[model samples]
Target: MDEIFHVAQTRLYCRGIYNEWNPMITTPPGLYFLAVLFGFCGYERYLNSLILPFCFAGLCRLRRFILISTKGKLKKEIDQFRDVRLSALAICFLPVLLNNSFLYYTDLLSLTAFIWGISFNSSLISSIFLALAVLTRQTNIVWPALNCLAISLNLLKQFLFNQISFKQLFFKTFKFIYQFLLVFAFMCFLVWNNGSIVLGDKTAHKPAIHLPQLFYFVGFTAASSMPLFISYFFQNYKKIFNRFSLISMLFISLFAFLSVNCCTLAHPYLLADNRHFTFYLWQRFFQRHWIAKYLAIPFYTFSAIFMFKMTSEIPNKLKAFYLVFTSLCLIPAFLLEFRYFIIPFALWRLSLDYQSRKAQFFEILINLMVSSFVLYLFLNRPFKWPSDPERWQRFMW
Candidate 1:
């Protein structure tokens, strides 16, 4: 369904009809612009496949940036070169990300732009990528804005603590603001677009304060990176369980129950679309029984707590900014789509301080298996819709 609009728009661009627009397509035209650069390509899917290399390049750059950022804290056992390469490969094959890579969707290109924006050291170049990111997807504006805020907050703390002179702080802040101008540009675009983030599909993509999205996102990170979570659990199981008293456990349960009971939202698209895996997940688990939603609370709690524990090794400044940015990104969306969780999950997965070789190997193996499974289902398991019997509907993430 989404491919219909994206592929058509790119074809129009290929024909030199740059003015054409699709009202059903909610994202900006950056993806189409990038697709046009391939000179119409061998096929639309092939053109989309070209974006994967750029994505991998950006991921490698991001891994290098992470290694440099955590160099002092890195374990002596960590093999920097091999670990970086494998980690980038593992992330490139993440189920949701890899599934979207072959489609004419904004997800891969948007993520690539965002990753380069974060990884690049040059302010002008970084801002260019960041602006391109927002041009690909309007919601991406929040990330650069959050990045700017994080830098400012960190600098302010350093200045306050007398660790950095006011002169140095002023120069650093200026450099950050200059590099992350995407946020400012995006705000200007929003005003020009009549205060709407999405260019089309305004009715369907309505903004709401759906708080349960945070829970769903956390659960997704936990599930997607289960190998690391399991490793963390075994290494710190005693410390983890010790933090949870009976009363704390009860409080967590009550909080999860209320969140599920009061904050859960069923979007119209989520209910109507069976071609996407989220629909089945909703129908099978969240809607299967009255207590099914409540049952998910424990998993959510476990994810949130353990994820926090895993990130405890990051610097205080970065950790605070990461949490703030993640919450702001996920808290407003009213949908349960897994694609929305991809960027935040990628950042979380990359920034972890303890990704041993064993964890990386398991991560790659599991992601490969899941990616192959989903690809098989998408290709071979086609079902016909009664309303459109001529069209084959395949399952996807």
Candidate 2:
């Protein structure tokens, strides 16, 4: 308890103007204010540090309510509370509760920023949180960028495809550009105020560029681009693909890949151990190891085959072509690495919404269950049970 108190106190004092050089204890100014309030009680300091951001995120949602009310747009049928609760549950509870609650990490902040951005549609607030997320941990950079790109693409779609009138397209483009400028300006302000951009202590000494890191980054890019290539090939061969759908798939695939990669790469210890390859392998195997993972491939292949079972929806010729393409492209890929194949499979499944909800639900359930089971087995057992016997026993107990 005393040690915890000392640590909290040290963090508080380190935030003082007099201790500007201490990089280890630095936190965002927003978090620092909360730290000052609860610093006397160490645990409270940490708790409050976590709670305040969540509170601010709540306030951000509330601001949206206030906006709607002021505009006299709040309707009885709106059920603002239900909407808020659902959003909170999905954005906050789903990821944090299932994945990494109590971690006090940037992921929470990233999610909050994401939710806040969606809630208010205020680029400034969203960009501020995103910038803080990156400053707190560089891994968070991808999500914000991806989100912005998603919004940007959606706007582009509206301007180019949806809007029939030139005037309407011009107006929408201007609105998007204005919002984007606000976000960009906010980010610039944050970077300027933060003095030195430090990812972490490990990165503080080294220059940003490294050759091996670049190579791995290139590999990740290639992996992400694979879906685009597949989509394009299908389109060229008079298959099911179209430009809009292809772009959307590429965006999502690249976004997910980048988000996962950035989060993984920011840790020096992970980089040191070449955990990238291990993570790649895990994803390749759908989070399983050698034999079990290999066995799962046949099941996955069967599932992919089932995807084509909805052939009644497609023209016979196109269906035949798609089946042949699926066999040649998806089967070989699934056999080699089911995890990598799963993304494309999912994209294709989602594309088939006109098929049937029941079918989609079953496909999704199977994918989730298989993937989760494999992950559980990998994380729990790996090569040997009780890799750390003490930790394993404690976990069980």
Candidate 3:
């Protein structure tokens, strides 16, 4: 769906018309620049095909980072290099990303940049990749911002725990974390010139206080990670009630209720673009009836609880940073696009240590199954718009 605009923009870039801009395109021209550099210049399909290796390489880096960071916490069987390779291969098949990889979309490269930004051992290189990520998609600025916040907070934590002296903390804090500054300066320029985060299609992409976007994000992720959720439940079902107090449940339910009732949004594109799967989802489920949103509160609450449970093994400070980073990424978008969930989902999935190979296998299998189904529908189930019968539309993530 978005490839048409992206292809045209890149064709202009291929023609050396770098000054041209597409008002319908919201992201920066970094993706098109990469296309030109890769010699896929005017050919969208070739560009998509060429990006797969980079995506795979980024996923491997991500797996290594996760393994090293959580060394002793993982099962011996699951920590092998073979398992690492397998997991990276499986993650490459993630439904949303795998579907987009065959199309001329910026999401794959944007995700690759984000992955390498967090996973690289050298901070300088990581920062540069993060800067490129922000250039590709402005929303990606949140990751570098989160990194800076996390570094500062970690230093404070070390000082509080007497793991580092005040002088050490001071020196660390003063160290050059130029990515945040660079991104901040670039954002200021954008705001000064364009007057908004969105460079074009401003009306459609304007920021909103869509609180329920968090719920949609959580719910979608929960549904995607169903295997993990199911396995976690079965393993802990006996103690689940004890761990979850009535007051906590009540509070979560109340928060979910308020988020849905007060801030549920329906973007115009979400309603009008039947070519996207979200349109059918919204029509058939979320907006089916007045009580539908209310009915969804329990699912949201459950999803949020399980997500917290899954990440409970991470350091408390890092967990807090994770939540804040995820909130910053998801809570502002007025649309319910699954594409926005890709990076956050990748981070969450890689952070986890799957207790059983069975669960891991099921997760991979589920992703493959869904990707195949989506691809089939997208290719074979074309439909025509009533107003434009000559044009064919297909459902996609």
Candidate 4:
């Protein structure tokens, strides 16, 4: 609310187009517009309640899409839709989604647009929803990127089968990306206007690698999602070192560098106080070589294994794209927050089997418990939990 009120009072595109309290114009105007709408309704909280129903509505549409996509592959036609839809709902209620829905955050808005984008069959509709998603949260460009890759691959397949010509595929690709040009232009405009795309006063947000935090993210994210695919990882150990995994390895290595340079992070609570530790590890550690080798590499490699095994059930063509997409979402951030892992976990959890009621039930229960812990952290966590930031930076993650 602090940032919202600060931005709300200002006329956009006016003279001195930056808020000293929360400058940089990092976030596009979507969330601010929604905040102003709810502010008029005069509610202190529970505004997410109004948006919650729409999120569920998006899930319903997404569930139908999932079922339709998985059709005839499953054995029984009669029970397939029910089971698939249940699994979709199960994923939808995971603590991350539940928690985000209660807060006045952009996660739900971006998620709604994302789910609806994937649900729609038309390229135009999908592009619009994805464009809105990017507007809501700048990092959401990955959604459109993944979509463009999928469409291009499909067009290639069509051309190979003689269903479409080379010229036709080229034009289609151009048109698809062009439809999203407005959204991209708006992002460029924000960066152009902000003068420094880095949010807030530059002094408040230093950049650092902090490989230890990346280690924490991979381990926590993997455990939170569960070990359902651990066996497959071992069984296909040799085959797992494919092109996609190689690319993923290089991507993680690249992430460490980009994050250190402040190139990869997006809206780490841009409008809020810069309370988060950015160059935290550098402030304390003289050396973190042990961490990069033993911690960062192992956790990141295992995450790739888990990602490969979990995504095996999905069609092969898009598997590599989703793996890259998932990695792109989490790795750029300065903070190692639980909320950062939600997007990847939510999408992968959809593949869980609803037939095993006990398994599904337990999964939801575990996630809910984690959600409870996160809620506790949000509500009651002490500011002095690690009062000495520089001294305790290693343990911060």
What is the C-alpha lDDT profile of model 3 across 32-53, one tens digit per residue?
8888887886566777676678
Which residue pairs in candidate 4 have backbone atoms (N, alpha carbon, C) closer than 3 angstroms, thus clashing? none
Write the residue-wise lDDT of candidate 1 on 245-299 in tens digits: 4456667667777777888899998999899899999999889998888888888
Q: Which stretches of candidate 4 lie over 4 Å from their true place?
A: 1-21, 37-41, 71-86, 149-178, 182-187, 190-217, 227-303, 351-355, 377-397
Q: What is the Cα-based lDDT of residue 85 in candidate 4?
A: 47
Q: Give the Cα error of residue 367 in candidate 2, in Å.
A: 20
- Pairs with steric clashes in candidate 3: none
* Cand. 1 TM to true fold: 0.89
Q: What's the count of clashing pairs in each model shown?
A: 0, 0, 0, 0
Displacement of the residue 10 alpha carbon in candidate 2, Å: 7.2
Q: List the global CA lDDT of all models.
A: 0.80, 0.38, 0.80, 0.56
- What TM-score does each of the candidates earn? 0.89, 0.38, 0.91, 0.65
- Residue-level lDDT tens digits of model 2 in 1-397: 0123334534655457424433443234333333455563344335435653573456436434543543446444333443333323322322112222232333344344433443455555656555554443333343444445656676677767755466765665554454455446546745874633332242333323221232222233223223333333344444434565456455544544443344222334323222123434445553454343334333333232334432224445544543343333322211121122222232232223122223323333443454455445435753423444443210100
Point out the worst 10-residue segment of candidate 2 by lDDT. 331-340
Cα error of candidate 3 at position 264, Å: 0.6
**Most TM-score-accurate candidate:** 3
Q: Give the higher-TM-score candidate: 2 or 4.
A: 4
- Tell me which of candidates 1 and 4 scores higher on TM-score: 1
